[model samples]
Target: MLFSLLQPALIMKISNIEDIPGHNIVEFYGIVQGSTIRAKHFGKDMLAGFKNIVGGELKGYTELLHESREEASKRMIQQATDLGANAVVNVRFSTSSVAQGAAEILAYGTAVKVVPHD
Candidate 1:
């Protein structure tokens, strides 16, 4: 999978619910998403195999997953911001194995504009 670093132009508030506690959704911009797949490098794969035998945490795999999630989230936030959304609601994440050694991570949500309710 190919991925480039993406920095969100704005900090978009994200939530797992349809609405923010103190704000009301003024407009819905539809869905936004970002996804990426990652496979371990040969060196890391070897290291992980050894660690698996030793029964300890596989730091290389851990880092790969962490970075993948960050990239996916960033891309999602960027999309939402570009659509004039101040927030993304009903945010969700999913992971799947696309291949024997590759894993795909996805982040998605509904982009919406919200205003504080009085």
Candidate 2:
């Protein structure tokens, strides 16, 4: 089910779990990771400040984080593919403030080759 959703955009399967259900991990290529740091522009930052006063969702910041996460995930997947991995297991994400207005998003997982059970 999840595989189908990911198939169009990526060849590598990514899962937070250790296993991929019907597939068996035949080989491991160690850890693969990717990260990106993002900061809102002056205009967006100003808007966010105003929104904070009203105590509402920061849509600008939300979109920025979403883009950062996607970029990081794509990079991680590319690294796994380069290592001859068909999937990434035990995937995880981390976020941290790199500066006052900048945040870093990281994606990491164990690269592995998997084969369907016979």
Q: Best by TM-score, which number?
A: 2
Q: Once model 2 is optimally superposed onto the true structure by TM-score, how far is the C-alpha of residue 2 displaced, in angstroms?
A: 22
Candidate with maximal lDDT: 2
lDDT of 1: 0.87
Give the range where candidate 2 is weakest over 10 consecutive residues by summed lDDT.
Answer: 2-11
Taking all chains together, the TM-score of candidate 2 against the true structure is: 0.91
TM per candidate:
0.87, 0.91
Quote the lDDT for 90 in model 1. 97
lDDT tens digits by residue: candidate 2, 5-117: 46633768889999888999999999999999998889999998899798989988999999999999988988888888899999999999989999999999999999999
Worst 10 residues of 1 by lDDT: 1-10
Global CA lDDT of candidate 2, please? 0.90
Distance from true position, residue 92, model 1, in Å?
A: 0.8
